[model samples]
Target: MAQLIDSLRADGICIIVVTHDMDLVKALDARLVYLIPDRPGAGKVSGGPVQSPDGPDGSRPVLLPVAAMDQRDEPPRRSSRSAYIASINPAFRLIGAFLTALPLLISLDWVSATVALVLELFLLMAAGFTPLRIVRSAWPIFLGAPGSALAIILYGKAGGATYWQWGMIHVTQRSLDLALATALRILAIGIPAIITVLGIDATDLADAFSQVLHLPERFVYGGLAGLRLFSVLRDDWSALSASRRSRGLGDENRFKAFFPQAFALLVLSIRRSTTLATAMEARGFGGTEERTHARVSDVGPRDYVYLLICLAVPVAALATAALTGRISYFGN
Candidate 1:
């Protein structure tokens, strides 16, 4: 591994190594970049060559000295109640999201879609999410729903009473009904997925996928590893932007500066990925035999309840629409 890193360095390639292995860092003579969390969505970075305390042959990474931020004095408080959406097995939650979304996508009537939307809102609240949190996380749906509805209202198949007509655009009672149904359907499908998936831990999801869903362990772990880099990328972007501002480049057009910074981020991501892949290889990640999980993932009664809700909401929505004579099958 040391020889590989040395060779890469010799080839004029820069490597960014992210690891706790001090020996590996020493072998590569890599500078340390310390990320100290000073606040939510913000942090401080201290970077320099760190000298090992054990006379340059230490087996542990040298801890960088970071000044205590005043904000760190009070830690964030934890919620007393466990999040309902996060408690269910991730596999079950995923399957439930799929089941709940499928019907909303297929239903072509306002009544069924409205029922599904109401049920989805109830589920979101049941999952312990506040209305503000739901809107914050699923704002795209809120915006896109109205936009989609307007598009459908203007361009959807026109029938029933004609309200307006223009070049390549028509509005009618049937089209307006379909538009409302489409908007409600978007909310129904999107809200549940966003609410359930927002707080899921990547590691837990990986475990559930590998153990409960019988997915390929290598693929699951690799994907989880990749997901871990998302936060790092965000931090890198913040740091990069800050550095640019400090260099008096902040006044430049952001659109012009975006490409260079994005390219730099892409380079950093590739280097990190290479290092991660090497570390995984060293840990025998892609061995032919199956590996055991440290923690077992299981589906229980709560998971069953989630699945039941997923199944029930769509059925009840369709049933209500049928009874009200508002059921409109797709394509007819």
Candidate 2:
């Protein structure tokens, strides 16, 4: 890999490697691009020569002043409320999502599900997600909801008066009610969970899981590493498609072409994962000894407040359902 990088550099190709393995950077003698956060939403990159910590004099890497480096303009900041929500501990957000989802998941009637969906929508808006953005991001949920509801109406456990029947497909009044409830329940549970996850930074989540939640560092960091590969996999797919088109294989049957590309992708992923695992082991990633965190993942009063809100949403939904005489348990 180092030889390939060196060869590419010799050919005047810019090979950018994003990694935490400082040893590899030192070995490559690569220029460092440090991203320094200048504001809440903005960062400035400062580049400098990499220094080896294992040098005879044990010199450390130097970070040039922001003014000395080529600087970019600051990005716009989000609303304070939005920023606060985003800053909350990801572990808490995860717990909050679970709390909010429980009631909606078990809801068997339309009223409770409807109430939960409304609350989730309100929460979404409060969290600064616009209606269009929510629809765009959660389009799969929107598209699948109706289809799922239709399936449920057609083939769900039949009860009450029959509305339609054709061969194996049957629709009844009870099925209709259940279908509507199911659709609303999906929206109520899925939207907020997706939004919460999208809002979290992968690195921040890993840090929270490791430092705040006391999860195994190996597992947390491994997951983070895998998540980072998603973008790489997307680019690889695009490149693979382009290569196939250039090779006159694009006109081949789509299903048949897919199998080869999928196999190639799997091979590429496995190779990358193996390389990453080796690098991580070299960096003492899976060591049994205690590891110190560079970033602190402390929970504060605001986090507690966020947790309370998470707890309150489901409680309120359930209470409202009970008052309306609409609460139906899972097996009712």
Candidate 3:
């Protein structure tokens, strides 16, 4: 339907829709017109209401908030998106993300972690990201860093100028320093890892695994098919929840409902998996015949350059900390 409308619009045909499907309305960017009803006391009924080309629905369309009137007021959605990062081979992207995080994992020093974070921020910007976009993808890591830091601040190695103490909790200078380093390290390792892996296609990754890395196809394709079913299972879960609610079973405590809901979902999932396996077997998934991939997977110069940059970030960070005599090994 959308394609038909687009083709018609391309040939200068006016596309007018009179349905109440808000999804379709927004999808086609259709203008809405309604017959204005007469009020109780203020006014009399008028002739057929003619909608003006621009002000047909007035400044704001009187509709539900979900059916937005003006598009301009809505903010662009924040996303961890980077064409450059996604263009790299999936295998190499994962390898590079691992390498980028490896060095910071070795030492617990604020200087190195801070330097790594700063350098990674610059790289993240080069990958076409803003602060908000990174945060959008990594808010869990952001929240988790402070939580870990709080733990370290309270109960970590407590020496060198004590500040506060309460039973097992001890606040000290060393503890504070360690907490800061831990937080910085978590951020330095997490943000780039999350962003780089944001847009990797599952099929592309499976292709890379099978074609480039030569992993077992049975496992690789099985994982890929399982990943594809995630959305289907999610929809099934929603439907189950609605069914339960309509049957008056969802009014119970969530904890009490969780077991039965989970059991039903599990049963449905197993049935779907059985059907999927049967279909795949019919299509020769686990057969003896050799298989081919639709997309080619290989690395190039750009991937090498990306890997080098990933290596350089931690190298520079650790070097700075080492030169400044602040680099501290784990558990030392």
Candidate 4:
């Protein structure tokens, strides 16, 4: 393939080599200049490789995948932050994130939760996500965690001395402690989970599902198709909203206008899904023959190291909680 590409370049035939293979570019020592057509209808794609005029001897290849791509950077520059993340296998990242949070469920004591959160915070910083970046990417986790904590604070079965009482809401020492533990636990579980999946490519995850996890190809590819079209839904919603505004419905109550807009979006989704299904069937995806993947997604030494850290964090948290006499599983 390298020889063929070099021969083609020599023949003055410039072509777009679509790939997500960073190693291929590095191995060929070829620089890529990404181009997105200046057309609104040109969907913002995430990964495509455009060979630069500079051939193999030019310079080291820098990965700059050109696309706004799912509300990410437009003509995205490969930041160091994303580079660290993109190195891991998507399947292992998914597994590790869950593993790191799972052992925290051994006990819901504030000690364990706080210790785990602190360790996770350090790890997140080490992974090139600054405090600000983590929050920006995982704001939903932050918002939901506090809301959950607030509910616990308000009505979490008052125990020990009460601090304040107003109607059904009682602020007690035990509730305060429980709320703190709940908040910390949510952050501990949610932050790393969010960060692991920050820049995950759907194709890579699909490949991982098929190759690493041995999932059915039909299910994996169908999932990939769904993820790809999810961005289209955003575009469809925006277009629908704009169309409504043009028809002078923009000033109407948002709550009242929501149902019609939702119904329209659902109709559009069904039409698109039908077309996509037809296309997939035409491509032989409906056949019983086993399909082969063009790329591989396997765990490496780094992945093992990451898995170790995931195991260690929760163990250390629980151990520390036990030392403080705060750890109790299932209220035992």
**TM-scores for the candidates:** 0.64, 0.65, 0.67, 0.65
Compare the candidates by TM-score and give the number of the best one.
3
Give the C-alpha lDDT of model 3: 0.82
- Which structure among the candidates has the greatest lDDT? 3
Between candidates 1 and 3, the lDDT winner = 3
CA lDDT, every model vs. true structure: 0.78, 0.77, 0.82, 0.79
What does candidate 3's lDDT look like per residue over 1-332, in tens digits?
Answer: 87899789889999876664566665665456553323422122235343233323435343222222222233322223776786788888888899999878999999999999999998888778898888898899999999999999999999899999999999999999999999999999999898888777788789888877889887888789989888787789899999999998988999999889999999998998888788778667779887755456768899999999999999999999999999999989
Candidate 4 positional error at 2, Å: 35
Among residues 3 or more apart in sequence or in different chains, the pairs in candidate 3 whose N, CA or C atoms overlap within 3 Å are none
TM-score between model 4 and native: 0.65
lDDT digits (tens) for residues 1-332 of candidate 1: 88998899889998777776778866776555554443433342335343443423434544544434433333322321236766788788889989888866666888998898887777677767678878888899999999999999999999999999999899999899989888888888898777666666677788889889998777888788998777788899999899889999888999999999999899988998889888888777878866655566768999998899898999999999999999988898
Screening candidate 2 with a backbone cut-off below 3 angstroms (N, C-alpha, C), the clashing residue pairs are none
Kindly list the per-residue Cα lDDT of model 2 for residues 41-98, writing each as its tens digit: 3343335433345433454444433432223443422312356667678888898888
Report the error of model 2 at residue 116, Å.
1.5
Output the lDDT of residue 218, model 3: 75
Clashing pairs in 4: none
Task: Report the lDDT of model 2 for residue 102.
Answer: 78
TM-score of 3: 0.67
Please report the TM-score between candidate 2 and the true structure. Answer: 0.65
Angstrom error of the Cα, residue 72, model 1: value is: 28
On residues 145-185, what C-alpha lDDT tens digit does candidate 4 reach at each position? 88998998999868999999999999999888888888989
